[model samples]
Target chain A: MQLEVKPKGHTVFVYIKGEIDLQETERLRQEVDRYIDHHGMDHLVFDLTQVNFIDSSGVGGIIGRYRKMKDIGGKMSIVGAKPTVEKVLIFSGIQKIIPLYQTEKDRIKAEK
Target chain B: MNVNEKDFRVKNQIRLTIQSRAENVAFVRACTAAFASQMDYTLEEIDEIRLAVSEAVSNSIIHGYKNDPYSQVELYITLWENGGIEIVVEDHGCGIADLKQAMEPTFSTEPGRMGLGFAFMQSFMDQVEVKSRVGQGTTVILKRKVRQPVESKN
Candidate 1:
């Protein structure tokens, strides 16, 4: 998976591409953690618009990160997950905890 | 959890063997996705097959083999003339002690896991069957029936 991190307004937006599975979760976790730590961001945003596939491992990784953000009094949000990836995330029951936005503007509106 | 062979007829088949490794998960996903594309499946249907296969293979590598590179994982895919498909992912690793509990959504024996492998398989596919012997190995069978003349939800 490819990730590009953009730090904006106390939030680190992670744009991920390709697939998120067992092989990519570890690296994604490490990299996102690094960006969160280095940028000292107070919020995390995941841009899954380009991500096509994810499995349980990816869900686990996302939850782990969510916990990390919660521990630090920070927040995380996700935007633009396609129907397929959204199915797995919703089936895992993560939407109950983290906020999911179908578009970038939708998240902005909700946060506002 | 027996997949009665009498339920469907096979028109095409493919079998693959790969060492248990994290990277092979994508390889297996791509191969199965490509194979499913041979049928007149919708993009969403094709994506479901990809996700289910990914979850099964990931379980084999992560849970069964425990990331052991020396172990091998086997996959058997059969295509039905009606655009239906069945896949069996088998692994020779530590097997689950309780199949029912393992299939439970969000129940994971592994630390820091959501344990949604079987959940995803069961949710996206028409049928999911698992057979495992503790300390022996595990096999995951996934099947999806084609919805003929079904158009995309566009």
Candidate 2:
């Protein structure tokens, strides 16, 4: 998986493309954490439109990052997860914990 | 674990170039679930096997490769002759210093995560084996039996 970070004012947008499974979970977690720590951002959005699949570990990684952002008084949201990847997230109970947006524009609007 | 008269075996292989990270967990989950489905294993058994396989592969990418984007993780799965399964997870990365220490429950190289991958394998699978050497690489072998139990006449 590839994670690209874009700074939008006080929000850090993370655009991830590819499968979020055992192999990419750790790096993704570290990268997200690094961005949050470096920018001290209070809002985060993960773009998963290109993600083909996700698993428990991937779910755990996102949850882990979300908790980190939460503890620091930040908000987190997910945007554009494909059906299969989204199902895994839902199965892992991530949807219950994190809010999902229909589109990137919608996500940006929610951030406002 | 239980044993029954009828048994089946199947082998599946999937290889993809991945920039290793924690997200690989999902791939492992999907693959393992597909494997279990082919074997017709119960949901509980499938879930357990999925978790075990994910933990093993996660160790390979996280500890073995240390999240190197260029490296690849190879997974070979063999469903045995008697409703048993074995998975071989391999990675070309810096090998472990002490096998015993690495398998310890509290010996995680990363923070905020339990050093419990090895321990989880031991608890979840019937057998867990590791082969590694410094500067070479590492391969983790995991096996589990998934059959209905048979009662013997006394």
Q: Which candidate number would show the highest TM-score if scored against the true structure?
A: 1
| Tens digits of lDDT, candidate 1, A60-108 | 9999999989988999999999988898888888999999999999999
lDDT of each: 0.88, 0.73
Per-model fnat list: 1.00, 0.29
Model 1, docking class: high
lDDT of 2 by residue, A52-110 (tens): 65555677688888899999998889999876566556655567779987798887687
lDDT of 2 at A51: 79
Error of 2 at A71 (Å): 8.3
On the 0 to 100 scale, the lDDT of residue B105 in model 1 is: 81
lDDT of 2 by residue, B41-136 (tens): 667667567767777777777678886767777777776556667778887888898999998865777765546567667866789989999888
Deviating ranges (above 4 Å) for candidate 1: B1-8, B149-154
Every model's TM-score? 0.92, 0.56
Per-model DockQ: 0.90, 0.17
Q: What is the lDDT of residue A56 in candidate 2?
A: 51
